[model samples]
Target: MQTIRLTDLIAAIEGTAGPMGDASRSRRPGADPDSAAEHPTASGAVAKESLTRTGDRAAKEGRAPSGQGESLPVPRIVTDSRQVQPGDVFWALRGERLDGHAFVGDAVQRGARVCVVDADRVTECKGPAAEAVLIQVDDTLTALQRLAGWYRCRLATSVIAVTGSVGKTTTREMIQAVLSAGRRVIRSPRNYNNQIGVPLSLLAIEPHHELAVLELAASHSGEIAALAELVRPHVGVVTGVAPDGDSSNPSISGDGRYVAFESSDRK
Candidate 1:
């Protein structure tokens, strides 16, 4: 996993960073000067101590920190409070069945270094363990997507987006298997092809990954376009289209290499 500084993450999600309790008072050695200038709030003694403490806590919990740095390293981005680990960033997402806001306190208690929550529900996240920072955003889901898109643009990896009604997942897996022989490839986990899953998969990309094969799925109009905008794949592949499947054409960008299979049963 790539090391994501707290300041860059705040900027990427267009979120407001809040004070991080008492740990933000001391300084950690070898802090990045350029990163401090980018976001003053995360600079000097405050950021240094906060990050050091986070790393220390992770070590005590038997989890090794990803890197030794002045800047805080977010080891992982988790949506489930149960999976929260020291130095992880917990993104609160609202779903139809369960609201993540309800778990904000639980996440903080579990050693999450940061909590990204909707601005409107910020109050619900108050009174946490105080060791974590709060990032208030307009919408958690949209912010997640935006951050993933921003991160993708910074990577050197070539992305291949696979979308179609019936064979999207299989196509993505096949591509990953073939590419893995020669390159460091990352693929969508399981059938993760929807809005939430797509962004999560993209965020899981590591700095060493040479290629990414993502499966894109849509249950409604405009979803494919939205996912495509975030992916901006170097190559787009459509397996086959069916009348009952998503007919929305994927809008590919950034190189525009595309391949589509013509369906003989097209109505």
Candidate 2:
């Protein structure tokens, strides 16, 4: 996987990066104040400085930086505010039950260096969030998926997507076990096969991973197809057709190679 910088992530998600309080401002040492005000920090110096400080702290604590860079590495990405550590990037995702926007201040208080939020909900990020860098996107979930897809393209890892209504987990485990013998393999953890889970799984892929076996699951139509676009698997597998009307077969007509496996109780 290639190193993802703050600029790279902003571009990937099509987000606008906001300043991290006054520190994000770039003021020349001897330049006129008015002239310095005219020039915003578009050179990524703020990003570099913020990440460098965070990276230094993480290093002192014996923790690795999340994403790699030339001078300053990007911080770890976290969705749950409780999981956030100093210098982590907190993505505020609005789920069906809980709204992550409500916890922006909490994440910031916990030492998140960056907060990614929906453009419309920027006002929800108050207090401590003002101290952190803000990345505003149209939709947080979509931006996350886009980021995952962008990151996936930079990896040399070969992906294998598995989809089915039944036996998907079993099949995924089987494939992972078989591939683990000689390859640095990673697979979807537990039942991480949904929209959010799939992207999280893809983001978990490291540069050293040779093969990734990801399970794709869907409770509605077109979900599998959407995920497949991000996964862009080198090999696609179907363990069985959906028992319900909604099909679990992913569209594999693109560059992905297809394979079908059938299972029946009568056999």
Candidate 3:
């Protein structure tokens, strides 16, 4: 029926610009100043449709321009085949026990507009879904991360990322509730603070959103740092520091304006 087109929402990004993070910037800054290209870990190279436009830049790169010409609204991004819809982009993520590639056909049958798959599985990407855009990348998970990073750089929304050994979710919720009183606030959903969840949370940001409070969770080293590069928050809050467990929560804030960390002494 009715959809919120990027053409309409894109105006919100016109004059707003700031340094988000290196992870969020486009890999290749082309002749067209507005075009953004993504470099997924699947391959060191850019994805065929990663370019926002389909002009000389696309021709020079020998790929079709994707994000530029489509007046049709870009649909929501989803990982599950069951959630696939006519306009949604289905990411076929591979899990240890369950391979998302197996459900590609199901996603196509359900009317997915784009299907992201592993580069090695190009042969399997056939039939009805073939008509939809097939973005072949080195890794679907990394592609998801890159896509979120690319989208984040285009907006001027203020980001506050929360991470710690404990209480990250509670802190994030409290921040969102307080901020929502005056601003249009966006926050991480449930425990969506990991690799997949963090990217999805960033993707949910709209042009109208003034603040984004993302709760980052980590059980190991470097996980928070990796996620921080994606968020590049204006404020980073670490709920607590674990004396026993290794915590990367503080490191996840990057070079932001403010970073709040708890003392090692547990009160």
Listed per model in order, the count of residue pairs whose N, CA or C atoms clash below 3 Å is 0, 1, 2
CA displacement after TM-score superposition, residue 46 of candidate 2 (Å):
21
Residue 242 lDDT in model 1?
A: 56
Per-residue lDDT tens digits of candidate 2, residues 1-267? 244566667655642332111111111122122211121110111111122223434322223334233222355677788777887778777654566788888888998767777777765674447666666666666667667766776777888888865688999999999999998999998767766677778878888899899997654445556666667777878776633333333232222122222111000
Q: Give the per-residue lDDT of model 1 (tens digit) for 26-136.
A: 121122222111211101111111122244444222232343434566768888887778778887777555667788889888888777777777765756634566666
Instruction: Give the alpha carbon lDDT tens digit for every residue of 129-173 in model 3.
Output: 554556566666666666666577776788888876678888999
Off by over 4 Å in 1: 15-70, 244-267
How much is 96 displaced in model 3, in angstroms?
Answer: 0.9
The best candidate in terms of TM-score: 1
Taken over the whole model, the C-alpha lDDT of each candidate is: 0.61, 0.60, 0.57
TM-score per model over all chains: 0.71, 0.70, 0.70
Alpha-carbon shift of residue 178 in model 1 (angstroms): 1.3
RMSD of each: 13.2, 14.3, 9.9
Q: Which is the better candidate, 1 or 2, if ranked by TM-score?
A: 1
Best by lDDT: 1
